[model samples]
Target: MTATTEINKIINEDNLVYKKTNLLLDNEMHYCPGCTHGVIHKVIAEVIDEMDIQNETIGVSPVGCSVLAYNYIDIDWQEAAHGRAPALATATSRLMPEKYVFTYQGDGDLASIGCAEIIHACNRGENIVVFFVNNAIYGMTGGQMAPTTLEGQVTATTPYGRNTALNGHTMKITEMIALLPGTRYVTRQSAETPAAVRKLKKAVRKAFENTTEKKGLSFIEIVGTCSSGWKLTPTQSNEWMKENMFPFYQLGTLKDE
Candidate 1:
């Protein structure tokens, strides 16, 4: 069979998108009020539902707010230790190559504790998908300093604002990962606006496509909001992320191979 024909055989309409089935349960998300985790979770669920991978995929939840995502995704999931989701995903994907394995991690998990894990995963070209959330601060632990936090930003730990001289500088994880040969796809997106969410869905689908092709790593960094951490209402938080962060972080596909 031709490569195109063979690939098409596995992805047909009768089994994709579960419009008839609501995979997510309606439990109250533990994320702080106005946090973007809920929107990101829903986006992932929608993609999973649309792709019809509900029964054939595995998800790894890392530390921070993403740990409880299994409750909402309605799929087989595993929780990785503190910041080991990438390592866990690598092992799982290597063992079950046909099963779509993904990791949902935060800035603290992906850019900090799991730094080596994710970088290795990308360098090794593991056929895994990573849903990275960069909300600037460490939201789950009452808003502390994070690797992605912008300069002059105030958090519980950075009471006087982040100082380049003292705290170093914020790291751009997505752009850094894009430089790795292991990554077949890399993109930066946000959930601040409906228009942005629509664009994010396309990136999410491409990440899964990379996996189906057994290409390499797929990394998508989402600029999310932390209302509780930022001391702003939900609406205000979203606006702030757009105004102050989006220009620096921007949003778009970095590469596709």
Candidate 2:
């Protein structure tokens, strides 16, 4: 056989172990190399595809590094104002109670300016999924100090390292949300390794399953990386995240009901 024929023969479904989900578009991603957004996006798409809910799913992505999420996911999407994705998602979920609705938000947008929006939405027990990607610092906005920035961590705004007295303690938003009565499922996950990615995928699938059952709000916090903002290579960023971020944010399910 010719080289092209041999390649095509090996690429058939019978031989293929894995492939990109159809729910994810073929467009080139714009996220910085090594950023966890792409991996998270893939996991979401895979869940939606596996559940065969692509047509019944809608995503809301607000201003942040994830603002362009709509460009990659094939499902219908709505762009919300900075920190307003939860509000928009709430409305969407209420208006179309049969459809699965979710919001993709970044730390700066969700933990900072969008704090009130998320709290109220969760407090009301809105039947929606909230994907909170917490990279600690503000990744899209010049690496500024964010609400979740680690104490004594350096950022553009905190060149001298974050001082507990001067900058307030790091916000553990996930834990705070877990305590709310409205949240039926709350978990913190990461996507750094093959095993970690599998866990993250399982968490997302569970969240979507909850949506199908009309359960209360499901919150998934992905403790992720921001290599560009952190000024480190992708490998180094992963190591740094496991060393620093995991100790504070931790991982695994915080609440399930």
**Candidate 2 regions with alpha-carbon error over 4 angstroms:** 1-21
lDDT of 2 by residue, 157-231 (tens): 999999999899899999999999999999999999999999999999999999999998999999999998888
Per-residue CA lDDT of model 1 for 1-257, tens digit only, reads 11111122344667643133466767777777888888888888898889988777899997788788887777788899988999999999998999999999999888999999999899999999999999998888889999999999999999999999999989998888999999999999988778988998888888998899999999999999999999999999988898889988988889888
- Count of backbone collisions in candidate 1: 1
The TM-score leader among the candidates is: 2
How accurate locally, in lDDT, is each candidate? Answer: 0.87, 0.91
Model 1 residue 42 distance off true place after TM-score fit, in angstroms: 1.3
Error of 2 at 170 (Å): 0.4
lDDT of 1 at 99: 90
TM-score of 2: 0.91
**What CA RMSD would you report for each candidate?**
6.5, 6.4
Q: Where does candidate 2 have its weakest 10-residue lDDT segment? A: 1-10
TM per candidate: 0.91, 0.91
Say which candidate scores most in lDDT.
Answer: 2
